[model samples]
Target: MKLSPTYRMPLKRRREGKTNYKKRLALLKSGKPRLVVRKSLRYIRAQIVEFDPKGDKTIVGVLSKELKKYGWNYSFKNLPAAYLTGLLVGKKALERGIKEAVLDIGLHRATKGAKVFVVAKGAIDAGLKVPLGEGILPSEERIRGEHIANYLEKFKNIKEDFEKIKQKILGEMNG
Candidate 1:
């Protein structure tokens, strides 16, 4: 009896559920840098990456934890933190001469007004051109940490802190 030929195995990242080749191929086809946003339980990270024949090269990268340098003292995985990280990465990318990028939310669901989109909105606010549809961003109030402020008494100062950190990032970017 003839047996079928040995089946090929998927790439390690694909088998481990870390990479999606189809989506990645589409993003690469756009011929723009990728704004890669990834989140964990306690942190968020944003990077501007360019495709290379040998491997991907990161143009700029920022972690939510880096917000501490800008005086952010809240949860690093929250919406506001994601935005700040995005903004930071965006500004850094701009400084590196990258003006636009395509969003690459790997394996993340495309939820409207979600943290990922909030990051995209922040990048946009930082003057990075990323193509997004209408109404994809969270409302301004949410991005400002007003929701957290309204949810708890101790967070009453979150909005003020958010504004301060935002200004600091922008100020440092310009100066």
Candidate 2:
């Protein structure tokens, strides 16, 4: 018995679990830039990306580490840092005249109040119009870093630091 040799291979990205073509297609169909938020164990990054035939162009990219420029002195991967990064990206996007975008979390699960959503909340606060469902963002206390502050003695002032950094980001962007 001879077996057929007409097997088709899947896309490389799919095999590598990187890109979800179906999701990408849906997002592209909306005709809006994508606010892509991704997180690693030690960092969070957000980008305003526009789809292109050749490749995706990142209009604005912000990393949690960039928060240091705004006076953030805590963990870069924390919830507050994610929010600040989002704010920075949103401001940058607005400066480039991108008024609206859609959230693209990629293959990450849509966990309620996750750091990714915190980033989205921050972007929303920064005047970028990214459509997000209600109740997906974290609570005010969490976003303010009160929870982290209360969790450790050394982090007692995290909430205050968060506010100061947040103000600095907004002020610089507005000015």
lDDT of 2 at 172: 76
| Local error of candidate 2 at residue 128 (angstroms) | 0.3
* lDDT (10s digit) by residue, model 2, range 1-175: 7697678889999999999999999999999999999988888999999989999999899889888887888999988888889889988998999999999999899989888898988899999998888788878898898888888999999988888888888997889
59, model 1: CA deviation in Å? 1.2
Name the top TM-score candidate. 2
lDDT of 1 by residue, 1-175 (tens): 8587678889999999999999999999999999999989999989999999999998898889999988898999998998888889888988999999999999999988888888888898898999998677778898999999999999999999998999999898899
RMSD of each: 1.5, 1.5
TM-score of 2: 0.95
Off by over 4 Å in 1: 1-9
Per-model TM against the reference: 0.94, 0.95
